[model samples]
Target: MILKTYRWSFVVTAVGLVLAALYGLSAHLGIFQAIALVLILSVLEISLSFDNAVVNATILERMSDFWRKIFLSVGIIIAVFGMRLIFPIVLVSVTAGLGPIEVVQLALKGGNPEDPGTYGYELNQAHPTIAAFGGMFLLMLFLNFIFGEKEHHWLGPVERALEKVGKLEYVQVIVAGAVLLVVAETFATDHGRTVLASGLAGVVTYLLVNGLGELFNVEEHLDHGEHPEGAEAEASGSEGRKGPTGAAKATGKAAFFLFLYLEVLDASFSFDGVIGAFAITSDPVIIAIGLGVGAMYIRSMTVHLVEEGTLAQYPYLENGALWAIGALATILLLSIEIHIPEVVTGLIGLAFIVASLISSIRYNRAHPEAAHVETEATAQAG
Candidate 1:
């Protein structure tokens, strides 16, 4: 059953290994060395992206299967080629005032890669603005979750405090705006205009995409009492008159937006992090094949979690992922001015997720048939 669930990932692994081997033979690199490189990079990618997969699983479980399929297929292409290979090239083009074709040509030829004319050098310089956009979006993701989700408290006092503060309308927006301002003023003195603009774009993009998805999401509307009890019966009757077609249409729209959100989220994660992959090797082909294999597995892991109801079993997992996202956002915002190691970022996120999983296991063992009545503090005390 486990093999069945992850069969596609295995297929991708095999294909990547074969390509890695061919590249190695052509380049006169030892087969063992090439295989090792592929394996190492793939592991690195999965480790860095595990939290991402968990968070994605939460959102993806809500989407329709058709959309889910599209995510695995089309989304993989976007992630592997578009974001990983082409996005940075485009960034370099814009930054260097050269055509993207010229950027690609520079990357493929033998030259001083560190030269300003080369893709490698210019691509390194393009990270700050992308970080600004990604950081703000992730920050908003974390803030919105901790504030609005009052029922579940993962970290005793912090979650409770945020929930209370969230009672005020648009509190998340206000806090996010303040954070954006602080990052711009404190960290982005050199390129404040571009950073500020990118950050603002992230905020607005999140609002539009997330809002549309939520607006169309029936469960979300029901959970938040978008339709009052007095009018619920009327709405149900009206919906009944319209039949399943009406609800289905709304669901499809929601799924489409949800798919968009996932794509953006993937880009945000990749923009700041994938560049770090270059440190392992300057060979773009190896980076692409290795990371592509890892990405394929992450997508598979997400689907397996949804299909197997892992999130339901370990409810605190999502909370941990959000906390990690918050940490990542802070790091990204700070990283614009200073160097933050990728391993440090990955470790921080991994620690939160692992701690949350341990907490969940403890709660499950204590409660047997766990009720939502338990709190993290009480579980620890018990």
Candidate 2:
């Protein structure tokens, strides 16, 4: 069953290896060396992205099977090509005023020899803008989760206090805005305008995507005539009478928005991995193949988590992932002024996840009733 569920992951891994080997041969890199590099990159990507998988599973569990399939299939393509390859190339081309062909040539040629104008070099130069955008988006994500009202709390008192404060309208947005302004002022003095613009763009993107998703969800609920017990239903039954076809259509629409949100979330997570890849190699092709392999595994892990109902079993896991996201966002913003090692980022996230898992296990042992309640909730949600 495990293999059947993750067959696509295995297939992608196989194809990625074959492509990596071919690319290495074409580039005159030894086959073994290329394979080794791919392995290393794959491990690195998985290590950095385990929290990503946990967070993704939380959302994926709510999606339909059709959408989940699309995430595993088409989503992988976007993750690999759009993020691992095209994104870097486009960033360089646009920022450096180089044509697509020239950018490609520069990428293939690796770092610049005489001037710091190669694709990788130019891409690195654009890191501040990328960090601002991704950092803001991730910050919003973390804030929304922590500030929102939730029944289950990993850090009971702290979460309860935050949830109370979350009663303020748009508290997450307000906090995120304040953080962006503070970071831009303190750290982005040299490129304050650019950072501010990018951060605002990030906030806008998050709001637009999340708003659309909620709109679709509300529409779906209306179509189903589902409302709270005390709330009155819409008088016009036609809106809810569309039947199965309407329900399917509504689901598809909601799924599309969910897919978009997931893609953007993945992109935000990829900023670090993509930038960090440069430390391993300047060759764009190698970076794509290696990181692509790792991305595939992350997708596989997401499906695995959803299929296993891991989150339901370990209730605090999602909280852990969100906390890690908070840390990562802080690091991304801080990176503008100070150098933070990628390993440090990865370890911080891992620490949160591990701690949450241990806390969950202990909680379950102490309160078996909570486990039973979680199982029932999982069943209903499924």
Candidate 3:
């Protein structure tokens, strides 16, 4: 099972290790130290993103095989190169008015104590904007998950109450917008406008991506007989309607949007990881190698969960992840006012995941019939 599921992950990790060693040798660092740094970074990224893996699996299960492969393959490339390396450089270059090469050189040279024109300093200066964007995006995700109607409830009263409130149209967006305004006005004094603008942009991006995903979700509509008459006839006549060909044809559009959503979600999750890496090392290349390895492991873990039917077995796993996301979002917004350790963030998410696991186990024990039904359904779906 390990070889079948994580072969790609192992291969990528080996390559990452080799590249890390080469990078260290070029920098005149000892082999052991370089290897150790990469290991530490990989651990840090994994710790910070375990909940991310669960959440990713929840979405991956709904995707087609083709898209899942694309997510694991192409998605890893974007997560590593795009977020880990290119994003910070682009942010620094844009905000600091420095060329891309200059930004990269600064990243490699590390921060200068006397001079303020350093990559770390520039990135720090842009932290508020980054926080605003990532925090708001995550806030919307959390609110939508918690507020939407759910059949199973881990935190019964609280979840049910939120669902009731969620009945109000656009309640999630309204609450999220209000929270953004309050955070910007109260905490982000120096960069309040920038924070507000970035936060709004984040909200807009989330809405657009989510709306497009729904719009292109032809499979769900077709399966439910919600398509127009002509389309329904075409769908019904196809091989006794085992599946909708329209859905297959339109899968590309849906997959494209889903891919975009996953990429954005990964980017939001990386904001803290990228920022936290500066605390360990100022070298962007090392950070990229280390975090990139961790990200690959995450992608592998996501696929593993989907294939193993982990979420279907433990129905509350997704709920736990969303709870962790809500907490992380809150922390991100609060970080504008105070310094929150990465350890604290990781621990909080782990706590939720653990709690959810326990809850799921208890639920399964209490309702074996439901559990069996879910397992059979999952098997058939797979």
Candidate 4:
């Protein structure tokens, strides 16, 4: 049944894997090596992005069908072509002071370990800026979420602490700014200027994108379809709300900004995937095709989670995903000083997700009545 919903994703996966194999053959990496590279990178992308899909679904559920169509169509194209392919090439060109053709030549030198112009090494050289930007953008997201007023508290004590602190204006910004400042002053000294600028750019970008989204939100009280009845109203209580929300007008400037916000959010998530792909192979073609395939699945998963009312059913799932984002954000920042294995990153996020899934199961079993009520509420909201 789940497979039926993901029929398109499967189709994409099949086509993508085939393309990966073909690219491998043409590159002379052997069909087996190419397939292996693609598969490893696919698993890498998928594992890192489970939290991303859940986060996206929360926003996607509130979007109108028209905009959702835009997301499902144009959104994937940007994810595949822009982030997976163009962005990496552009990054190398600009940062390495090499022309686009030279970058391509270096990328094509996949197995030449001795080449100083190796795509992976140049990207690694650029990591401080990349990590700074991605880290701060994602950290803002995590801060907004953790500091937001919510009816549910998965980690009671920790969340309660955040709730109290969130009442203060701009606490999230202050905290994020302080962290950036300290990191810039300390571990990132080598690229202090660049890191500081990139980190601030990230913060400012979040404020503009998310602030514009809230500024023009037409349906301030509209919850994403998965929200339980009275949850927002109860949380709203009076003139109060924080954190990024999906509910907005379907057309005009509101939809455009909302779409932009999602695109930015998508790019932030892709940073890790793009950088991490270097760990496997320096073949730009293989990385692009494999990660592109993985990205398609995430897009499809977002739609499935929304339509199936999965978030409403597993209430803490969102919390778990956010926790993963928080971890990712921190890891990205810390990665400047030390190397973190991709396996470790995947494991940390997966652990949170599994724990939350277990908690949600227990929650449903313990509160069978609440489950029925929420199910009905979700149907009505739809």
Candidate 5:
């Protein structure tokens, strides 16, 4: 089912070099090098992002069809350019006087590894801090998703509060103001202000896009056909379409918040990749090319997961995503205070996600009957 829809993308991507040389955007990278970098990084990023894709699918499953399309196109843009391209430059500029353009030039020049200062910057020197920050940050997020009980605010107290606030004309403005204040205080460092600014911009973007979308009733177009209660029951007794109007709208809200949260998560994830890529060479061009390609694959994978309902089919993927989030969060904090290697943190996270995916697949194959039972129960609730 998934393959049928995105088959063209897959096929064109498989041709690889021909496509990259034709469409690759980086100015500094050679044509052949760009092709090779895109192919390599795309595969790696896709593989690593499977868990993330699955998690995104769960939330997106409930979104209206129109919003899903927008999410796919816009979300990918944000992921590759916002996180991969712009983020590394932000990091380098803050910590050192290195301009992003200069870094890319250095990366393209390419120097010997043993001769440390030849490129004037080494991604390796930055990895330890990236790892330290990424690891701890992801750990905290994992715990929050798995053990931290969410209050289903829309269903309970949160809903009540929102209802009360909704009557106020300035509620949204107040919230936006508060968010800006918090951002200002949190990202006060000379070097990190850019990251903070970018993050804040993302938040504002999400709110405006989604809030206006909701106000204009964009999702109303996606309402499914209604059937007479008894007639519909006779035609489809077992399978039921869930997530009605209110639920779908609520899910849209959730997606907006989730996107905002994940951008921050993506920034943290990039910290290690950006710095680590430099270790390979201080050439910002290579780092950008490699990471940009990887990010493209990640974006593609995220859309695939959303389209396929992977998370609903395999719940354990959520657990893996939770862990990945935690690991990145940890890396964020550690980068400021200590140093750790990106390789170590990335490997640990890779292992957990792979194991969880394997386990989920195995369990489903072995106990198809049990899976059916659970699906039936959920259907009945809907």
Candidate 6:
């Protein structure tokens, strides 16, 4: 039964191992070594990203079925391809105009394409732009946590003004464009411009992602007053119209946005992992397989968390996710200027996730009422 419960994960892992083994065979790597690398990376990614999965699960659990599938499939694509593949290549191209293949070869040859053992991982210089990206990412996350709608009940005066402007539709776009233009003009020389641009980008991204969700019919199973639970009949009666089932609405436009936001966060969290993995090995093939395998499992696990309603059952886990986000954001920012150990960041983030999971288990045990559906389902089936 436990195997059945985790069957999809087991299957995906097995498939990844097989693929990794095949790749290793073609590359003349020892079979055991290749499989070992795959397994190690998989475990490492999963361990490091437990908190991310939990936070994602919370939002995912609320999304509709269609959106959940998209989250799993599309999320993996964006994660593996966008971050691990495209980003590094883009960085290399911008800095050196080296073809991505050549860059990968350079990374493999130990800091020089011509010398395989010359540099090891520590000697390679990460592009300078990475610093800006990391710094802005961390700052935005810090501000988001402090100023988020969920954390702060009121939007305050600024958000209120923005909200009023947002109500004008075209006005919001004009504001976003104007903000971008201003940032572009000043970002080169002024710290304040960079901060403002970063914040604006983050907020605009959030709104765009959510708006897309609303358009996609991705619904959340949230009890937000707009579609309050148990008030459906009254809503229908008063409106003289049919209302969607909570589950049915969970995957509409809202789910699409949720998926987008989750993917963005996942990519942000993976910046360190991608760079750190290069330290382990410069083999692009190896890095791709190893990190790709682990990311797949995390994505699957996130889906399981949603299906299980783990977040709704234990809200504190949300705090764990937020904590992990903050930690990753800080780590990313710091990585720009300093080379912090990936293990340190991974352990800290992993510890929070594990703690949150343990707390959730305790909470569930103490309040068995949360498991009512599982109990009743089992009893009826029995």
Clashes of each: 0, 0, 0, 0, 31, 18
Tens-place lDDT per residue, model 6, 1-382, is: 4454356567767877888788778878767888887777777677777676776766665555567677667777777777766676666654565666765665555343234333223223442245344434433443444334342212247544544544553553454345444444654344445444554565556556656665554233243333434255335333321112122344444555667778776766666666676556656666666777778777777766655545555545665666666677656544544568878988888776667667767766876985565445323322
TM-score of 3: 0.92
* Per-model lDDT: 0.77, 0.83, 0.84, 0.80, 0.51, 0.58
* Local accuracy of candidate 3 as per-residue lDDT tens digits, 228-309: 2335545565322222112222246766887899899999999999888878877788889999999999999998898778
Which residue pairs of candidate 4 clash?
Answer: none
lDDT of 4 by residue, 45-107 (tens): 999888899998877765666776788779888988898888887888888999999988877
Candidate 1 residues 1-382, lDDT tens each? Answer: 6797688889989988998999888877767777877887788788888889999988886666677789899999988898777787778788778887787886664233356655666776777788889999998898899888543578979899879898999998999999888878877888787789899999999999998887776654464444423246245443321211122212466778898899888888776556777677666667777888888888998888766666666768888988999998898888888878889988999999999999878877877656343333223312
**How well does candidate 6 score on lDDT at residue 251?**
44
Expressed as tens digits, the lDDT of each residue in 300-374 for candidate 2 is 899888776788888788899999999999999888777788899999999999999999999899989988877
In model 5, which range of ten residues has the least summed lDDT?
A: 241-250
Q: Residue 264 CA error for candidate 5 (Å)?
A: 2.4
Which residues of candidate 3, in runs, are more than 4 Å off?
A: 112-115, 219-250
**What are the models' TM-scores?**
0.86, 0.92, 0.92, 0.90, 0.59, 0.69
- Alpha-carbon runs more than 4 Å astray in model 1: 27-32, 110-115, 218-250, 371-382
Candidate 5 TM-score over all chains jointly? 0.59
Displacement of residue 175 (Cα, Å) in model 1 is: 1.4
Task: Give the top-scoring candidate (lDDT).
Answer: 3
Off by more than 4 A, model 6: 1-8, 104-204, 210-252, 357-382
